[model samples]
Target: MTLIRSLAAALLLACALPASADIFKCTDPISGKVTYTNTKIGEKGCTLLSKDQNVSAVPANGAKKPAASPTDFPKVDNSTQRARDNDRRKILETELASEERALESAKKELAEQESMRSGGERNFSRVQERVKPFQDQVELHERNVEAIRAEIAKLR
Candidate 1:
């Protein structure tokens, strides 16, 4: 019984303490832009803005007041949310498929270009000129594939 009382007292004391946060203000000299952060300012030109403490009053009965609900907030039903998520997934999958096909085509074209380089174009500059466009196409397709995959991964 004594341990339970002591624990309850400790919890009440913790709840009664005010919450405090340290705020730091930083300014960029060149851009004249100001930024605030919760961390201490380690830069030479930054300043400690303020320490803010939030205190809430406890009722005499020691009960919390009921929160008022806002009527104007928009809400979506679970079915609607699921439908939107399904549509998003379908779009992302379609894009991924298209990107994958483009990547395969680019790889095939690059291989073809590699095989077509003749012994007549033995000069290094001629060889580079012939290979550069194919290499660029392959790189572009690879980047597209990666970007599509990332988008698909981000969807719910």
Candidate 2:
């Protein structure tokens, strides 16, 4: 309910509405809603009402235009969005490098655990940590790569 009023108010404000031009008499047709500029349906577009006529008048052009969608906005090339992706890629790469280092260290630790630790210690803990963090890094890198490719594709 509030959304409808907000849309109406936005249209009125866009048209520089009068205080009295606040009523709307709308009816639905097979094609769509036929919005009247005044109480009468003769006007084609938004027709200004005199003060007396406008006291209880429904605003014309207060309805949002049909076919108004986000896609109607201007388009941009992949290079523009690619810049953002590149920034993200740099960060992802840095994280991936750190993860790789950690993973390598973990693998070595697990290997040494077989020789250095009590026989009861299986050394599986280090390797378990290895799999999760490295897997996460690989997934992050894969997603970043896919996003960069998509941005490039958009430019073509």
* Winning candidate number (TM-score): 1
Per-prediction tally of clashes: 0, 3
lDDT of 2 by residue, 84-105 (tens): 7787667656665665665566
Off by over 4 Å in 1: 1-74
Off by over 4 Å in 2: 1-69, 72-77, 117-156
Question: With candidate 2 superimposed using the best TM-score fit, by how many Å does residue 16's alpha carbon deviate from the native?
Answer: 40
TM-score per candidate, chains pooled: 0.51, 0.30
**How well does candidate 1 match the true structure, expressed as C-alpha RMSD?**
18.9
- Compared with the true structure, what per-residue lDDT tens digits does model 1 show for residues 122-141? 88789889989989988998
Q: Let me know the TM-score candidate 1 reaches against the reference structure.
A: 0.51
Q: Provide the lDDT at 141 for model 1.
A: 83
Error of 1 at 11 (Å): 45
Q: After aligning candidate 1 to the native by TM-score, how far in Å is the CA of 52 from where it should be?
A: 22
